[model samples]
Target: MTRQSRAHLTDRGAPTSRPVSGPADHPVPATARFRTFRVAAFALIVLVIGGAAIGLVVTRLLGPGATDVAAIQVHASMGGFDPPALTVKAGQPVKIEFASMDSSMHTDGGGWHQFAIDALGINWKVGPLASEVFEFTAPATAGSYSWYCDICCGGKANPQMQGTLTVTG
Candidate 1:
């Protein structure tokens, strides 16, 4: 092809400026284009973060309602509840295992390892052994109940050896 023909051919399929281009290529300035991109990016980030937070909250809400309760075992002399608190079903058997280092209180013979679930109307006593099982329907209400070492025989004055029972129906 001739040089002129080649030049025409090259420009044929290309976008050409007017005899004199306008102020700029775009009606909206380049800065506006950049601002739009930044805004979109920020919106995407917010959506992602918000979705993650919502998912966490939903998972926690739909998770298991409650499970077996536990206690934090502490020496009678030291005086503190093992685990401190626990949760259990309203109509389920209860088990408390005590582990005490107060040889004087829990003599080899048999002292008192009493347990009280006042909410469930359960107040029973056991022995020096660190384990006992009580079969009774827990209180049919969901609330907090306090159980303490009634036998101040716990080597101290009202030792803070107390725990909470969270009963849920």
Candidate 2:
């Protein structure tokens, strides 16, 4: 075969310069690029919205701010309040945040658990799966005062549901 013919026909008689298209030959148009960007932006917005929803749910489940006025958290269940003992300075401002861990009882009317310190004239109640805050001033007289839950489990009579509050001068 002549050199020119040999160059044009591979031993198999196939053309060397077959027509083919690459990415550069078919450039993406401005509108298509904009649509792609819009889709990506929409996906990002969805992700952010979903994340925020999850955050709100988690926050609700975990409970709200720890911030308070002389905040103290007391939990009450069938077994009664945990940390039955508390201490404070005489005449000091005090705040108790009460939460009922009891799921068995309904709290639509206040709650099943009541915290009362007769001497301090403080009485507060919270229902199942609920919380409440109480603010008071410690008794002026420095002494050990009794506190108790007056509800389902028992009152001041039930040792398990009763606690002490000590006021120091």
Candidate 3:
């Protein structure tokens, strides 16, 4: 309970004593200081590593995946789309050949354009005349599916560039 002073060597290599503030006014033991620092560092490392692992796992689980079927393509041209109606097997892949009939009259500088097909959880998107392919696993539960030009080229009128893929099981 008595106030004790801490002793240390000064820059001149001479012994010196300075007044200390805690328990008996003595400097804390080196072992206790090292133990506290070690514990804190270990905890920080564990937390950082744990967080990264969780993030990595979540990303893998939620990201997109490749469907079992093959790819299909369709063509879009000026005025309308070729093969306005398409038929595909129930559980296979169909490729659509996207060709531009008249580049001089099509929107987007009289050339091909790009758009996305965001339905049925399928990520099908490609550029004009670029031959993009999308795969439908199986008949999509036996129903009619419509694909349209997401691009705003139609203005106030219907783009007439849309098409339908009928899945037959």
Candidate 4:
């Protein structure tokens, strides 16, 4: 090609004075951009405050160490309930927290344990390595009920896995 032809070919792709940058290249005035930034900052502040309020509400409603009522802790494992028994007054509302210690991967309900009783209508099944809290009202009749871990470790037949919930007047 001739020298003039080469020069024309190179000049065809040269850049112009118009910037190729983002939003800055848009011809909006400084005041308009500042207003957009102010709006975004205000929205962020509102979101943060709203999130903090929600968190505080949730913490107050479900946080541990409830002091208003009688509470008891019951732990479960491959062996049995920690105390192997529990006692409560008839018709009294009680909080029972069940904590599962071991993860039973080889059993039917893997890593899960249960405290079930048909008489008092209580059946609490907890996931492996986790804990759960529930409320219960003792039977008004006042008698002994069989509670057992009928999951993973063994059924009610296993003496070690069974316990008695004795309700008294």
Candidate 5:
């Protein structure tokens, strides 16, 4: 065979001038580039909205400022709670501050008072001569809800230990 024919048929360990074609070699279409840009922009927008929503949720769960009313105070003594009845708006956020006005020497329940309302999932406690503050949403439906101090002040038997929560529409 001729020298030229042998070179064409077999490799001589030398570089070739011909270029290999692949994805990198070809230019991307304008439509494909735009589609990728659109997807990226959409993802960014979704991320921003999601982050904002999460931030709002965290802030609300963390502070009592989310409630419309400043805290309403209630004092617990051996006789009963001051302001035997409370009025609130239905479906509204409320903040309550319950305080124990008696010393630990009280005989009812050792001066440890509890504020509980089973229907609204409220159960709070306060030490003798101390106070506690908490927040909760009023029931959706307007109605009367009963509250009591089961500890330091008798459970539910004492008329003085009972209080009524009036939720209005």
Candidate 6:
């Protein structure tokens, strides 16, 4: 109620307080803040650009054109073909890579196994630890074709080394 007390009171009769500054309250220069933001933005841009470059390179390497050639890898062991079944689109070009994995002792001199599909006219002798690539177009008709090892594992009636190729439209 005194003049000195009234000087510390606000219009609503509450005490007035002054603002206090701490170490965290220090103002940063506009250029310094902008430089930090710019560096972060540049790093983000570089990351985006690098990701796009990698995607482009991968697309060029494994695009549809590269996949136009159907690459199939079949391993032959004592059991049979590894996959035992293969599927391809009708009239599509297919590249089959056959590997003979049979390690049994051979006295007939026929190597380990022989891949043959009498219907498709695909017959290739694959030796142990060796691989062969056969390129052919799938049959125009969509049907099931059988393949088997003729030499080492007998014929289609034998279930051990027989497989089926399915052609889809």
The prediction achieving the highest TM-score against the true structure is: 5
Off by over 4 Å in 1: 1-78, 98-101, 105-111, 153-159
TM-score of 1: 0.41
lDDT of 2 by residue, 26-117 (tens): 23343566799999999999999999999866754453344454579887766666778889999989888887765533442233688888
TM-scores, all candidates, are 0.41, 0.56, 0.43, 0.56, 0.57, 0.54
- Sorted on lDDT, best first, the list reads 5, 4, 2, 6, 1, 3
Any idea what lDDT model 2 has?
A: 0.71
Question: What's every prediction's RMSD, in angstroms?
Answer: 15.6, 11.8, 14.2, 13.2, 17.5, 15.6
lDDT of 4: 0.72
Tens-digit lDDT string for candidate 5 (58-133): 7433322312246898877777877789999999998888877676676768777777898888998888766677
Clashing pairs in 6: none
Pairs with steric clashes in candidate 1:
71-82, 71-83, 72-82, 72-83, 73-82, 98-130
For model 1, residues 1-169, the per-residue Cα lDDT tens digits are: 4545644544554456633234343333446667999999999999999999998667433322223346323222234555667787876765554443233343422444455655556666544423343455566667778776666444223546577778887
Per-residue C-alpha lDDT of model 3 across residues 99-166, encoded as one tens digit per residue: 44333334553545433344655444444334444444645456777666544356214557576767
Misplaced by over 4 Å in model 4 are 1-70, 104-108
Q: Rate residue 50 of model 5 by lDDT.
A: 92
Candidate 5 TM-score versus the reference: 0.57
Candidate 1, RMSD to the unseen true structure: 15.6
The clash count of every prediction, one per candidate, is 6, 1, 9, 0, 0, 0
Q: Which prediction has more favorable TM-score, 1 or 3? A: 3
- List the candidate 6 regions with Cα displacement exceeding 4 Å: 1-70, 104-111
lDDT of 5: 0.74
Task: Report the C-alpha lDDT of model 6 over 1-169, residue by residue, as the tens digit.
Answer: 5533433333334334634334333232335667999999999999999999998667433322222234688777666787899999999998987777643354433446767888889887777556678789999999998888866655556797798899999
lDDT on C-alpha atoms for all candidate structures: 0.53, 0.71, 0.52, 0.72, 0.74, 0.70
Q: How close is candidate 3 to the true structure, as a TM-score?
A: 0.43
